[model samples]
Target: MWKFSIRRILIMIPQIILLSILIFMMAKMMPGDALSGLIDPNIDPATIEERREALGLNDPWHIQYADWVGGAITGDLGQSFRFKMDVTDIVGQRIVNTFWLSLATLIFTYLIAIPLGITSGRYNDSWLDQSITGYTYLGFATPLFIFALVMLWIFGFHFGWFPTSGSVSPGLEPGTVDYVISKIYHLILPALSLALITTVNTVQYLRSEIIDTKQKDFIITARSKGASESRVYNSHILRNSLLPIAAFFGFEITGLIGGTIFVEQIFGYPGMGQLFLESIMIRDYTVVTAVVLLFGIASILGALLSDIILSLVDPRIRIK
Candidate 1:
């Protein structure tokens, strides 16, 4: 297992390099340079050109890419043109916010999905199963942004039940119990929105897996061995059924990140997703490339995590 993990990490080195190169080149293809955001209407063209030269934006793409990569290797992600701070510092703050939000979303996703999936599978074609199926369909069909807006409107605006934007309420002293409560309170709407949308796939996949696994010969054999229904279902059917869900976990990470962008924007949440969108709009190449590269690394890591989880959940499967 350790050898397999090491090999996967080694493979990730080239994958990350390729991903970084692709992100850099794509950022270069944007219509304007990072200085576009800094350029003032009254500023002299020569002054702008001098600023470009100072920032090394005047260099060839390969040179710029090389410089950026070299800097990134040493943990310097360059300065954000708009924020006027190190990109690492900026991303560090936002990634923390995103992490909490993503964590909440993941928890909510499984909490909602697993039980419904199990029930639906256990009672296939019954009223309860049909109800869950309809719910999942609705969740899958609704656009995340629209759901966020509606939630913001009804729960945040109309009812004033939850904060509409930001990770925490303003003026709360950090480190206090109230501050922690405010953080969780502010997270509920957006996290729930993403969870509702994201769980559609998980519920459907798990439900199908469970249903399929129930018909397997092992489940029948377990039943014939005089095992209790609960034992047979839990030990034989549900355990094996989870294999596909384990595999799906990696893809779920990417999906959550993608959904986060729209949800964060809608909620005005301070996270990488919101930052990525804002950076692109202003052509903050430093932040854009950094965020994209981080996202790429996250995707690769998530896949690795899924593989480890898959192996752990089913002892029959070996990494080697």
Candidate 2:
């Protein structure tokens, strides 16, 4: 297992390097340099050239990429052109916000998906399963942005049950209980928006897996042995059915990070997603490239984690 993990990590090095080269070239292909955001089109040519030189944008693409990669190894992601601040610092702050939002969404996802899926699968062709299927169809059909808007209106604007946007209420003292309550309140709608779709998707996958697993020879053998139906389902069926679900958990987390962008934007939440959108609008190459690289690295790490988890859950996977 350890050897497998080490091998995977070794493989990731080249994948990440190739990813960086692709992203760097894509960023270079974009219409303007970082300084374009800061300088007016009417600015004197010599002035722009000097500014570009000062910022080292005058260097060749390979040189700049090498410098960026070297700095990244030292935990420096470079400064954002738009924010005029360290990329690490800016992204770090947003990561905390995104973490909380994603955490809440994840909790909601599993809490809802597990029971709903199990029940729906166990009761296949029954009214209960039919109802769950119908509900999930709605979740699958609704676009995320549309869902966000409907939620913002129903909960935030109309009912006043939850705050529509932002991480917390303005002027609340940060450490107090009230502040915590307010933060959670603000999070409810956006988190629900993200979690609803994920839950529905998870439920569908789990339901399918459960149905398949329940038909396996082992499940039939357990039934024939006169094990109680509940024990057969719970002790054997659920455990085996959840293996594939467990394997995908890491990838789901990375997907949540990417999904958070749209949710955060709609909710006016200050997270990496919002930062990424703003950075793109401003053509902040350093920030854009950094975020893209972050996403790529995260994806590779997620895949690695998923493989490890699969091996742990089913030792047969480790042998393979």
Candidate 3:
């Protein structure tokens, strides 16, 4: 397993390098560089040039990229031309906010998915099964942002139940309790929006796997032994069915990060997505590169973790 893990790490090297290069090139090629955000209409050209030189923006692309990569390695991450602070520092503050949103979405997806998946699995052609299947399809078809809008219209504009936007109600003080509660409140719309896209996808996959398992020789034998249907499912099917889903846990997390790019806007949630967009608009290449790198690291780490967890749960598929 250790040998396999080392191999995996080695394989990841090129991927990381490729992403680094891609991020560098894209950041550079985007219309207007960092200085575009800083230049004032009334500023003298020489002063602008001097400011550009001061920020090392006058350097050739290769020189700039080399310096950027070096700073990234040392955790310095350079300064955001837009925010005028260390890019890492800016992202660090936002990481907690993003983490909260992502975590809530993850927990909620599973909480609803697991039970519905199990139920759908247990009753193959029953009314309950068909109803769940239809519901899941509805979720799958709806775009997440559109779903968020629908939710906003129903629960926010019409009913006036929850706060429509932002992480919390205005003027609320921040702290551990308030912080957590604020997140929970803000998490609802985006979570549902994102979860809607996934619940059907996940539950349907799980249901199909479960139904397949029901036909297995072992399951039949267990049923012949007069085991209750629920017993057969709990003792035999759920864990095995969950294994495949478990393998994609990391990917799901990464997907949530990607999805946040749009969902964050509809909800006005503070997270990496909003940060990335704002940085891109200002051509804050340093900040853009930092967040993208962080996201890449997160995805690779998630894949690595899913592998480890899957191996632990199912002995048949060793990491080696």
Which model scores highest in TM-score?
A: 2
Local error of candidate 3 at residue 260 (angstroms)? 1.3
In model 3, where do residues sit more than 4 Å from their true spots? Answer: 318-320
Point out the higher-scoring one by TM-score: 1 or 3. 1
For candidate 3, report its TM-score: 0.90
Which residue pairs overlap in candidate 3's backbone?
A: none
Tens digits of per-residue lDDT for model 2 on 4-79?
Answer: 8788788889999999999989988999976777778798899989998998899999998898789888989877
Off by over 4 Å in 2: 318-320
Q: How far is candidate 1 from the true structure (C-alpha RMSD, Å)?
A: 2.0
Candidate 2's displacement at residue 203, Å, is: 0.7
RMSD of 2: 1.7
What CA RMSD would you report for each candidate?
2.0, 1.7, 2.3
Q: What lDDT would each prediction earn against the true structure?
A: 0.88, 0.88, 0.81
Q: Write the per-residue lDDT of candidate 1 for residues 1-320, one digit (tens) a residue.
A: 66666777787789988998899899888888767776684789889889999989989999999998999889899888788889999998999999999999999999999999999998999999999999999997898898889989999899998888899878999899999999999898999989988998889988999899889988888888899999988888888787678766877887788989999999999999999999888778879889999898999888777777766666566554
Global CA lDDT computed for model 2: 0.88
